[model samples]
Target: MTPTLNGPPAPPADTRCDRIDRLRAALNRALRGKPGVVEYVLAGLLARGHLLLEDLPGLGKTTLAKAVAAAVGGTFARVQCTPDLLPGDITGFSVFNQKTREFEFQPGPVFAEVLLADEVNRTTPRTQSALLEAMAERQATVDNVRHPLAPTFFVIATQNPVEHHGTYPLPEAQLDRFALKLSVGYPDRADELDLLAGAIGDVSDARAGAPVLAPGDLADLQGRVARVAVQPNVRAYLVDLGRATRAHAGVTLGLSPRGLLIWQRVAQAWAFLKGRPFVTPDDVQEVARPVLGVRLGLAPDAARFVLDQILAGVPVPV
Candidate 1:
C-alpha cells in the first residue's frame, strides 16, 4: 500500500505515550524505584477500578495514593481504619437541622475524588461493607438518599501483611471488588541509595510542581481508555484464562465474572500506558499476576508457584 504524504507515521510499538509519560513523572517523586509498579497502577487507574496494595509498611503505599491524587488534581481524603471505626465514619451521617427543620446529610472521607483506605483489613466486616456499594456503583445510598460521588472516584486501599493482630481479613466479595492487588516489593539497592541521596536535602520545591492533569483530565483519560480497542479472540482468551484459575487444582477459589471484566479493563489501561490503542495477550499476561493472582487462595509461596505455572503454560490465542 502506498502511504500518503504529510501523514505522520504510527507510533512505535513500545513507547510510553505522552499522558503516561506525564503520569510516570508525577508519581516518580513519591514512588521511587518502582517503574513496573507505576505502569500497573496506571493500568488500574485508567481502568476506573480500585487498587488494593498489600505489602509491608514504609514502602510508600500511603504516599503512592497521595501522589496519584495530586497528579490527577483531585480531592484526597484518608480513612484510617481502626477496630472501632464504624460504617457511619465512612459513608457519612445525617445530622438533624433545627433551623431548616430537616436532616441534612454530611459526607465523610468517602465523598472525595481519591480516597486512601489505609489499613483496610483492620476495620470490622460491618464497617468495611460501607465501601462495597460505593466502590461497586460509585454512589452511596445514605439515609435512603443516593449520593453520587465524583466521576473519578478512585479508591487506593492498603493493608499490612506482617501485622495481622486485631485485623479482620477482607472477605472474597470485597477482595474481588479490587481491579488489581499490587505490592511495591522492596526497592533495589541502587534505588535505595538513590532514595537516601534524594533525601539528603529538603525537597518541598519538588512537591510544588503544577499538576500535569486537571481533575477533568482524569475523567477524560478514563473515557479515552474506554475507547481503546479490544479484539474478540483476546476477549475469549481472558475468559478462558479466568476460567482456568477457578478450575486449577491448587486454586481454592477462582476469579468471578466481575474479575474477568475488571481484568479486561485493566488490560486496556495497560495498552494505553504502553502507547498502544489495542489490547494484546501480553497485556493480559502482564497484569494477570497482580490482577488475578491475588484472588487465588493459594498459600503465599504456593501462590507464586501457581502463578508461574499458569503463565508458563497458558496458550495465548495468538
Candidate 2:
C-alpha cells in the first residue's frame, strides 16, 4: 500500500512517464553520450539514496551533480573539501547574537536538497564524518540542537580514485552510506568533438527542462517504489547472493543487512524507472556494479571477477 500524503495529488502514470521522458531527453542533450550513466544516476536519485562518484578529475562529475540538482529544481550547495576543513564548516554552528541575546542556528551546505561534496577524499576523516548523521538521519546536530534538512536531501560526492596524496580514504562506515558508487569516465571521440564544438555555451542546456517532479511528487513516488513487488524467489536469490559475497575469499567485508536493503531499493527504483511494477533479476544485475563496488572494496579487476562470479552463481527466478 502506498502511503498517502496530504500534499498535492500525484500526476497520472502517463503524465509521470511524459515528464520522465522530457527530463531524460534534456539530460541526454546535456551529457551528449552517456545514456547508461544517466539512467544509473536517475535510479539512485529515485531510490532516495546517496551516491559516490570515484573517478579522475575533469570527467564531468561536478557537471553531472549540478545538472541533477537543476533537473530536480532543488536547492543546490557544494563543498570543496580540503584537509583543513572542519565538521562545523559543513554543518553550520550556532553563533551568539548580541541583538537577540541568544545564539542563532546557521544552516550549512548540508541543508540543501542537493549537496555536491567535491573530492570528498581530500577532507580529513573528522570532516568527512560530518555527513554521517545528515546522510542517515536527514538531520544535523549543532550545539546539541537538531536541525531538519530538506525532505529530499540527496548527496552526490565525488573523489579522485587515482590520487593518493593529500587524500584521506573514506571509512567503511562512510562508504556504506552511499547506495551506489560510480565513475563518469571520459567521453568518446565523437562526443568529445561535439562538446568542444559547443564549448562556448553555458551548461544551461542541462537545466533547460523545467522540473518534472517536485519534492512532494518525489516523496510519493518513493513510497510507490517501496511498494514495488519482488517475488519470493527473487528475495531468496538476493539473500543467496549476499551470502556468497560474505563467503567469498577475496572480500574482507561483505554487504551488511542495511546494504542488502539498499540494494533491493535501488533495484526497485530501476524497475520503476522502466515503468514496471515488479522487479527482475536483470534489474538487479543492471545496478549491481555501482551498488556492490562501493561495499566490496576489491581491486578493480578483482571486483569485476567477483561480481561476475556471484551473478553467475545465483539462479535467476523464473
Residue range 1-318, candidate 1, lDDT tens digits: 112132333333433556667878888777888888888888888899999999998888888888888888888899999989999999999999999999999999999999999999999999999999999999988888899998789999999989988999998889888988888999999989987887777765234245678557777778767766777788888888887787788888988888888989999888878777678999888898788755775556788888777767668887
Give each model a TM-score: 0.91, 0.92
The residue ranges of model 2 lying beyond 4 angstroms of the native Cα positions read 1-16, 201-210
lDDT of each: 0.83, 0.83
What TM-score quantifies how close candidate 1 is to the native fold? 0.91
Model 2 agreement with the true structure over 1-318: per-residue lDDT tens digits = 232242333323542376577667766766669998888888888788999998888777777777777777787899999989899999998889999999998889999898999999999999999999999999999988899998779999999878799799999999999999988788899999988887666655443345656667667667767767776777788888899899988889998998999899999888888887677888888898899999888877899999999899878878
Candidate 2 TM-score versus the reference: 0.92
By summed lDDT, which 10 consecutive residues of candidate 1 come out lowest? 1-10
| Best by the TM-score measure | 2
